[model samples]
Target: MTMQLAIEVDRADDPRLQAYTSIREKDLTSGHGARFIIEGKVTLETALRRGRFKLGSLFLAKSRLEPLADLLAQVPQDVPIYVAPQDVMDAVAGFPMHRGVLACGIKGDIPSPAEFLSQGIRAAAPSTLLMLSDLSNHDNVGACFRNAAAFGADAVLMDAQCCDPLYRKAIRVSSGASLWLPYAHGGTGMDMVNAAKAEGYEVWAMTPRAGARMLGTLRIPEKLAILLGAEGPGLPDALISAARPVRIPMSSGFDSVNVATAGAITLAHVFGQRT
Candidate 1:
């Protein structure tokens, strides 16, 4: 029999519970997987049934444990399954209530840029690549990938300064698309530009400058890399100077769109032209 440890609901107010929550976030940023704090029974059971996410451990209210007995059977016997009083689970998590279950899962490895690029070519018809330059926000990075996937972009390339796409917040914000999308990191923005050129891609930098062709007016090449930069700084002058700078047509008052949003619009335009 699995040893069932019961914790009181009020115990969530204890320092230990607070510590556990803090540690989980820290672990996620450090590329370590932390146990997920699942609320509803349905979500927990569904995740287990899917079998894609590795469940490390589970926590449940004693009353809810029996209802989840069959689900528990699906998990490995050695995985710790704790029973805490409903109130305790709620207090510890700083929530009003938990629908009765939580689980921990192992962190998966992030694929190399080379591996992602190869996979993109194999999977997509005509590869569309989005290269990000020094964008630091994980949310923006993840949103970019999500939009890329949605807009038919084949792969994403990140300069070294971009946030880790696999970071927990990024993954969650991306609605988990970050896991499925092919992406590369560690390469400098320029290195990516060179690689894309070598792969027979025409690099286009999205920038706001005089004499730059409007996005709608320019003819995008069939094989292309759309280069984007951080919000305030935009692309490096050298990069913009080196590649073709294209501007999206915006309303008179608007200065610029969010980089991710701009990426989506450009991707739509380019991919639309291809098909």
Candidate 2:
């Protein structure tokens, strides 16, 4: 596809730069979808190698473009490439940048929850799954998805408050696992819990509370939904009380592992013992 350069900016606060800056939750909800921003040379090169998202445009500091010559040659001649002064590029992205190249590409859409669940059942054994409950940080959410994929969790279910898996930062942090791992989000986390139970999944809530069963001793179920909550609060009291609670064995004096780390350890255990 022919790519066209739309605008170039010399300053971060330049009006043309507004679309790329402030890509937080509020901005996304207002309906401005990013055509994927490729920040830094490494990430840009990775995207080029994969060739998944549709390339839109390329931006680079003039000094750095020489090193990327072979990669640039792969681009269609019709694609617009912009050269900017190093100072202007750094200011525009809000950091002293290492990778001078950035590109814009189309962001892919996530499938519906039902579609994701059905796909998971078809792809793998009816096994363990990770369900996130209102985990808001993009980094944490991305890490959880990465761990789930690594440890053979069948899929991920995000509650409504969780960050969008397709968000650029989350996708990057996931190393593109977010694109391949099956996931669906809708309604409250509790609703998903109930639905999993209806599907014969033994839901296990991961918590550090006193009465919870030690994860090591419990008999892992054949079909499981590993429920996790946000870092500070952990799982909701009602949710914990409803599902069988499981706690990871931890050393004394350590408060708790980060939710993503805890999830990785828990999922590894569950996958390890599967019959």
Give one clash count per candidate, in the order shown: 4, 1
lDDT of 1 by residue, 73-170 (tens): 76665666766787777655455454656655554554445445544464444668888999988788878987887888877888778877656456
* Model 2, span 111-180: residue lDDT tens: 4454465454644555888999989887898899889988988788887778777666776677666656
Query: TM-score of the candidate numbered 2?
Result: 0.74
Best by the lDDT measure = 2
TM for every model, in the order presented, reads 0.69, 0.74
Model 2, residue pairs in steric clash: 41-99
Report the Cα lDDT for residue 191, model 2. Answer: 78
Give me the overall lDDT of model 2.
0.73
Worst 10 residues of 2 by lDDT: 1-10
